[model samples]
Target: MKIHMLPTGDEVHRYQKSIVIPFKNSRKVLSTSPLNGGYRENLLSAFNHDSNPGAGISCSLRTDSYLNDLKLLATEIGLDPATATGISTAASMDNVAIKAVSYENLTVTAIVTGGVEVNGGRVGDPASYHEARGKTVMTKEGTINIILDIDADLLPGTLARALVTCTEAKTAALQELMAGSSYSRGLATGSGTDGTIIIANSQSDLKLTYAGKHSKLGELIGLAVKPAVKEALFLQTGLSPKSQHSMLRRLKRFGITEDGIWNKHGVLGEKTLAKPVFIQQLESVDREEELVALTSLYVHLLDQMDWELITPGRAAQEGRYLVERIKQKYQLDVEYTFSWQSAEETITGMLANFTDVIARISAGGPDV
Candidate 1:
């Protein structure tokens, strides 16, 4: 292990598969770690570990045993096992991102390691039933883990508030990237098994009473965390705005699949073109900026209707208008009729019809 001292006088030990931060002095800590979690005044160190269990290898560490395992790791790293708190992930430690920001007198730092391939999910999405306690069931999958440090003293309640600010910033980052939920037709807020730790300086004389959105501390926390999480995600999984620029990627949240579109194309009796040709043309059109922009608007309309900000009738009207614009712009000879069935049926029919039209247009020409 090699030690690198942070600007806040903390030493970060970088091991091959872990990053450990040992404070020069005991610090105030709050975390969702399975070990040494919750409020603590005498924490000596914090760490993030990568337990990369490969294929056919079991990763689910029993809770009773894993606690001792982490403690053993702590002791090996010259930290007091009784005073160390940490989180774990399958993301590579080499991809960790460290970001720091400062105002006139306050400094905030965020360290993040993120991977959202298998577990990305939105809040309120349906969940699979699982029962476990304290680090048990360590599945070998993606997760986002964050570690935060503040250079100034803060009240215990204020530290808790900082955690909230950090969480919101993380979600905002995922939203900006348009990350899709694994379980629903919604944008992911975070992975299902994410963890976070927030530490504040107990030795500093500058004490803060609040860390809400209005506070400078909160602003710094957001500034540090959002971009750090984004960078870490990109490093771990190649997710970025550029990677999400396709219409298919945008429409995937609505349960749109390539095979679904191809089936819809066959149903329309448009078998003149080969399936490979249709797919090639579809890929070409999927990247068109104007078409993607229209798709984005249509998706937002669906979202607005779902949120009750707009009526289904209004959304259908606007969606059909957008389709007309696409037809005119592309000069395609596709036809669609609106269904006034139940709201669910109407929405489903509209999406099916729209996707079918898109498939026809893609099959018609290369310039579409």
Candidate 2:
């Protein structure tokens, strides 16, 4: 919320940068047994058995506006925030960044990202729950793991789609932040041309081989705008005056007005979202510092997989193992492995959703 002043005259306006959101820790509180025991003793017994009453969970986010906006959008679309962790927004700013900061206000104390490392520390809490006769019931009880990341451009408040048009410019400005030598200098560069970067060196050859590797990066960027570009043809004949104007404004950013709907997806293909990559570094020695280590590892692994870029079988395998490890190490209670897809899938699904929205609007337009 405050601007950080640099040694140079100009100010580096850094926002709160990030916030950590915590999952619920409360359990169902049980009523005291009346006939068997008195209220206080009954409550004590329950507590002693590690089945005591639980406090109500706090409503999570620090800002009511965030919680409300998320719930409102979810309600409007008949979506469950829990089920569809992904959201489709035409807003200019990166909704992922905004929501991430918002979630930070709730329960996450610190966050970690990047690949697994011995320094990443062990997953699972050391805290233990005990039952009657003082036997340990659970090593760690009620700890929920959270994995989240943001991908869209500059995060803006809800507005007319005109704001979404601004994403192109906003994203460009954001990329400039990393070019600053302070963050880039000695870090492991992914390749001579590939903008993909890894921060530190590792003895692990898989990482070292790709340390500065940029293979396939350019090819991927070339494919970035395919879906959006493909949707533009519908705009020519089907778009209403207002929608057509919006489409034109977006086209202008990519210089596609001249090329007739060139693939602009290339723009996003250059770099993955900032948050996941940023978190990966933290994941290195993160376990000792935080509880969300599993979530961070999950996101980092998901990033490496790049959901759409990986085969479905590989993705399914990664997803399964990631969930399985969390379950085994943390003893977590989760719905199922299949319930959570790679983060890549979430982004791809989001893009598909955006394309669908554009198509629906085009079909419903007055011109149509």
Candidate 3:
């Protein structure tokens, strides 16, 4: 956009323009967080949804499907936490032939295949079986090889093993859920000189210039620019050492350089650096000059710029398109990844841990 500059004064000052871009939409698939975990709260607060009208609404996680997957994995080994604990404990105890442990009220029975009974007529005796009484006639004996099954003094470490397995399985499921949603993008910016101000009686046009380009929120995240000054030529014309000193001080403060002729930027002042001659002149001149006086008194700003383009929806598809376009045109690899867990998956995983455990079953007989 082109802007007209009117006469400010013999002396003038300028400022550099900068651009900022704050938000950008992402095209990557992100997992939603559980409703109860307050992940949604965190996301909404980050975007400042309440304060900013443009900011979109909050999104929710997809849980049912995710939980189903967790359930499937949990039952994969036919080992609930309870069963797993029993089997693991049995294995550790060297009770090589243990098959199952059933709990009835306060009593727990260890089922063995190739062992004799423990309490019956075989306790402490070099009976047919070791550490147990052999099953006798009519006792449902398998294979005429008199076998004995007995419970160990210490039961299987069922509780601990079951807890560990369930916790581990649930955690894995949670991760999978989260991996489904998370994202980020880049910002764009610009820089240059804009507008003019009159400083002093030098009749120089002030210009704002930037050493380099700066990026802001594409929208106004905030504004941070200093006003341009005008050297008071009146200091030289009239006897206002106070004004001259102030102007000089301002020049020093802004680190303004003199190019012999006039400061292209505004002149600095300590406090009230003499009447703004350019503005005064414009007031006396035409309507156009008056307009310049109003705008040229301070630093001018454009708008914010953003490099990212994140909108809601088909993230993968949009991401592919964005990446391809960026690579093809700018030869830039504008690729980013995001992941998130759904509300259902997150809660379900936690519930699964709370509800189930592994069950251990040991087959009696030889190592086979």
Candidate 4:
């Protein structure tokens, strides 16, 4: 693909391009497919996706049939199916994994999973182990584990851009089910401004399946998986007493019985709780930008979390469950092995802490 940028102004340029792709031993053809949206980014070589993977996106709907046709589709798009590898989900009686193919530009050097569980952190134990971990949330907060690996060249000073592009792509792929949910950086509600991030790198490390690839296959897969991870996040509904206590703790300053925060995207009601799959049934005609905006707001909402309520040492990791499910339901058996960079329970211990937590849970905690 050759891109021609002619100066339209000191800082802006009009872009024109043509991509020549040879298909299945056929002659090369000049393809002039227009990139989505007429605008361009200020960043050099920055690519954005509308988050819609074509051919009706799905992870497990028809695994056998899908994989069988994947090669043909890859060839159609001028991609080498062999390089279209990396992660695959696998399940066993004991555990589930998302395995990577080979090292790509951006590799998965270490994975430090973070989350919260009231049961594990006994009373006053101050289990600081979970403390240092990242991205903690309440019971009502449903989230997914996204093992992302951007191009090594693109990693410099591109944190916010990469995150935005990635989030937008994923949200667009999910379309509706995730419309009600939001995400934040840092630890839960009250934690500092620490967005989801990468911590390490090396000369040789495992690739994140199709991560960091510049290929169209990699791009589509990335967008699809972000929403797919939603299923896993939904399963993380085991509200913790400490997490509840922390969530309710916010009320101490206002001295109110109800949760005051307002952004309420993923709150679950009794019926949805009873019928877990109901969460998946929810759909959206909302645009990709809306979900991306929601995620940005999630980063903003981190200020409300009472970090004091989280156990000191017990960070929780919950994506493996989804990996297993994808394998079981979709036949996408590829285990995920994050560089073992070392890495939850209980509700009723609830009343003991926040008297009104039941009400908040029942009513769906503050959307803010």
Q: RMSD of each candidate? A: 2.4, 28.7, 41.8, 20.5
- lDDT by residue (tens digit), candidate 3, 1-368: 11212122111111111010111221111111111111111111000000111224222212243233223322342323211111000000111121122222111111111111111121122223332453321111100010011111111222222222222322232222111111111000100101110011111122112111131110000110100000111111221223222222122212221221022212221112223533233223222332223212210110011111322223323433433442343233223332325423322332222111100000110111
What are the per-model numbers of colliding residue pairs?
0, 25, 86, 34
Q: Over the full model, what C-alpha lDDT does candidate 3 score relative to the true structure?
A: 0.18
lDDT of 4 by residue, 1-368 (tens): 32221111111111111011111111111111121111212211111111112334422422233233434443444445443211111111011112222233432211111112111111232223463565332211122223333223332333334444444543443333322212221222211111132211212232232223374434544543443333332234323222222322232222222322111212423332322222222111112233334322322222222243433122111223333432343243244332222111211121112222223223332221
Residue 97, model 3: lDDT of: 20
Q: All models: lDDT?
A: 0.83, 0.23, 0.18, 0.26
Error of 3 at 14 (Å): 72
lDDT at 102, model 1: 90
lDDT score, candidate 2, position 162: 15
| Of 2 and 4, the candidate ranking higher by TM-score | 4
**Model 2 misplaced stretches (Cα beyond 4 Å):** 1-291, 304-308, 333-335, 339-368
Worst 10 residues of 2 by lDDT: 192-201
Highest-scoring model, lDDT:
1
Q: Tell me the deviation in Å of residue 248 in model 3.
A: 52
Q: Which residue runs does candidate 4 get wrong by more than 4 Å?
A: 1-140, 143-147, 150-155, 158-160, 181-194, 199-224, 237-368
Worst 10 residues of 3 by lDDT: 357-366
**Candidate 1 per-residue C-alpha lDDT over 1-368 given as tens digits, one digit per residue, 9 for 90 to 100:** 55455656997778857899988886899999868998899888899988776555645663357677677767766778898998888888888899989987788989999977678899999867545533345634668999999989889999899989999999999999988888887889999889999999988888998998899998999999999999999998888888788889888888887778888888888777888888888887887888889999888877777677887787888888889888988887767667554566657867876797788777776565
Best by TM-score: 1
* Residue-wise C-alpha lDDT for candidate 2, range 1-368, written one tens digit per residue: 22222111212122122211211221111111111211111111110011112234222322244334444444344444332221111111111111112121111010111110001111121223334555422111111111111111111121112122222222222122111111111111111110010011111122111101132211122222122211221221221223322332222212222122112222323223243432332233223222234333433333345524555445555655655564454343333323336454553443333222222222222221
